[model samples]
Target: MPDLNWQKSSFSQQASSCLYLAAAPDGTVKLRESDNPDVILTTAPATLGALIRGIKAGEFDHIRTA
Candidate 1:
């Protein structure tokens, strides 16, 4: 894939690894982390939205560490 205009996540902390996202020219969504930009993950917008919603609903809370 060519270069994308990645935007940092608003919830990112100044001292923590940040999340970044961008929209590809083909309409698919691109995601990466500030700590590891070389590894990019692509997915459909709807799938990403669903993941966000699931996150908001505590669907993955079981995986949280103390």
Candidate 2:
């Protein structure tokens, strides 16, 4: 994770400031809010891709309400 470049989601608003990203060197994907960089959640490449697809397909719409 030496050269990892963390990027926030394009959909993240300035107010929310959530960080969502895919990291190289191991192809691991991670999600963490910009306000809290110390706490990161990681997932395998395949699962990460699937979750991204689900989000794009509106499978996580409940998150908006919660």
Candidate 3:
């Protein structure tokens, strides 16, 4: 994964227990939490975009609220 330039969220401060992302040459995106880098979530850009949109719309807020 050396070529995978992992990037963290800008919102992450000094204690960066945030999500990290990396893109592969094949166009697949990988996501992982800084606290557990070993576990990765692989998905397409479209799916990721939907997730981001849902997040922005607070559609998944029920998960946290529940």
Q: Kindly list the per-residue Cα lDDT of model 2 for residues 1-66, writing each as its tens digit.
A: 565677875677783577757476666776677777778888888997787799999997774443
Worst 10 residues of 2 by lDDT: 15-24
What lDDT is reached at residue 8 by model 1?
A: 84
- Over all chains combined, what TM-score does candidate 3 have? 0.81
Q: Clashing pairs in model 2?
A: none
As for candidate 3, its clashing pairs are none
Candidate 1 lDDT over residue span 1-66, tens digit each: 788898886777762588889999999999887878899999999999999999999998886568
Cα error, candidate 1, residue 5 (Å) = 1.1
lDDT of 1: 0.88
Model 3 lDDT per residue over 1-66, tens place: 557888987889854488899997889999999888889999999999999999999987774443
> Total backbone clashes of model 2?
0
**Could you tell me which residue pairs clash in candidate 1?**
none
lDDT of residue 23 for candidate 2: 74
Which of candidates 1 and 2 is the stronger one according to lDDT? 1
Which ranges of candidate 2 are over 4 A from the true structure? 62-66
